[model samples]
Target: MRCGTRWARSNHFRSLPQRPDSMSIVLTPQELRSHLERFPRVSLGYYPTPLDHWTQLEKHLNRKGRFYAKREDLSGLAFGGNKVRQLEFLLGDALAVGADVIVHGAAVQSNYCRTLAAASRKLGLDCHLVLSRAYDQPEDQGNFLLDRIAGVSIELIDEPLGAEQEARKRRATERLAAAGRRPYLITYPQSEILGTASFVGAAVEIFDQFQGLPSVPRYVATAAVGATQAGLLLGLRLLGWKGHVLGFSPLNGGEYAIQEAIWSGIRAVAQLLDIEPSLEPNDVHNLADYAGDGYAKVSTAAVDAIKLLAQTEGVFLDPVYTGKAMAGLLDYFQKQKIPPEEDVIFVHTGGNTALFAYHREVLSLL
Candidate 1:
């Protein structure tokens, strides 16, 4: 399906005011909140996560601009991360559909898997995890260790592709059904749309938090797997915000493929909200140059970025996702891609707990 075509013909969507030439379309938080309330969402994390100013880090970099962090790290889930926001909607949908068990697939140390396992326990539901050895890490460390401690059923696969992992989850769900259990699969491909809508709510929060600032942010940066970036982009679009959203990829997909995935999510969100897709193809920006070796691998730049943030701002970033995204943000600043005069916001989509798994690599950086 085309990215913006799905909801383009809707008369209700067409009646909405066009974005002004100055790009200063004002949308109140309450309006967005009203639309979001139409869907069922369970509280999974602390709301209105702090928007912290990183003055020391900005000073260290000698940036003549403001640097702010949206602390989704302090989200207060199992270990707290962006996944908590997604899980709120995902698990709520599961319960709404009368599901008795939850199924998800990711790397062995996936924060997503860990958080989902914890959420299932809290809700008194069973969780089944399909873990892949895609990162070539130890069997028991970081989120994997937490998974074991949570006592969820787990199935291990050796570096399965996307389709392979889905098939495994499908089989597991079938078995659960046969055993007289209702299963809810939280896999990325199927559930991203619902999970993504959470961040649209997040975007409204960010915009409202910055209302009294001296100047609004010129850009918002986040680690991109499509869901987070696409949701935030759609939120900004629906809110009529003028700032750009930059996504830094942690994996090897080139810019085009990443943009395509993000656009697919935008299309989904537009359909979900029954609104016109307000973004163009060029509006989705994904920087893949900073991925370094690959996903879940340590890199000098990411290590340095992690250390710098911790040392200067007392903030911790995971090597896999946020660290690399921060590296890109710093690089953009140094290269003048982001002009020094413009303020920027980095969404700290938390993964500090994963640091223990890469202790050796992280220690060597010191």
Candidate 2:
């Protein structure tokens, strides 16, 4: 019935040894009361999603590390994905500040955009999206299809004019204000980190889940982005998760660029939680070696990894984010960089629907 602890009742973990040392890291109701006040958020997900062993996948990895998955993808809103967790807090903040509408910018296939649309609908707020030409959807599939189905208003910004997109969204907000709509921009530098808080809450959930387990993970790998990775790292520090929070960037940016985003998100966490300013930039770990050809463009290994997982585990991972991250994880396992018997949890950030677009490439791999 509790957040992270709810998984304790699942049949998956029932057969495993009940190590007396195994413990859960969720916050007490009292602690949550204090922790939540520092951050503003919306209620958009079912927190403490199940943590289950990927025994099938783990065994295949053939590494010493134990493999586990924190199913944030099952967060229980808008067809489930990790973004729902962040939206719960991010949108909650927007509403608390009297925002009647929310706007964001991302690629057309952005899970964030789709999930935000769903969050806006649930909270009775209008939603607007600005995306680059590459994200433009002529037919609608994956997140794009879902966005249309959700009835989210759209503005397609051709080319790479980042400033123009921001200005347009801002102008849209102004127009809404003129129309007596208390629109919330949910723009970057503010809403970005607010969305990250949910992930920090997630980190706390992870800490609780691992507390009872006798063995500890040496590394926890997950896809990186502006928010998900940030929240995970912050939560690790907050709860003192004694493991390497490995962020495998799906995009092509290098360590410093990725670290900058993570640092900003970390600052947001510190400010929201009144946490000590003790975190250092060096504390963050980026797995840059795995980003093959850069963001969104499928790499050879990424294609292979997707096929391997589908055939072996029957778990479909999206080509853009989760699939690529899993590619890195599998690579590490094969290379023997991750030691055997060490506990490792991969955060499955959900985007399987996106795979259909790359059907030809994916089909070739199988």
Best by lDDT: 1
What is the per-residue lDDT of model 1 for residues 103-178, given as tens digits with 9 covering 90 to 100?
8788898888899999899889999899998768777689899999999999999965477887888788888888
lDDT by residue for model 2 (229-331), tens: 8878777766655567788887666523777878888886565455553467887877666677766666778877777777877777877788888888887
Identify the leading candidate in terms of TM-score: 1
Q: Which 10-residue window in model 1 sums to the lowest lDDT? A: 1-10
Q: How many clashes (backbone atoms < 3 Å, residues ≥3 apart in a chain or on different chains) does model 2 have?
A: 21
Per model, state how many residue pairs clash: 0, 21
Task: Report the Cα lDDT for candidate 2.
Answer: 0.71
> What are the models' TM-scores?
0.91, 0.86
Question: Where does the lowest 10-residue lDDT sum fall in candidate 2?
Answer: 1-10
Q: Output the lDDT of residue 235, model 2.
A: 72
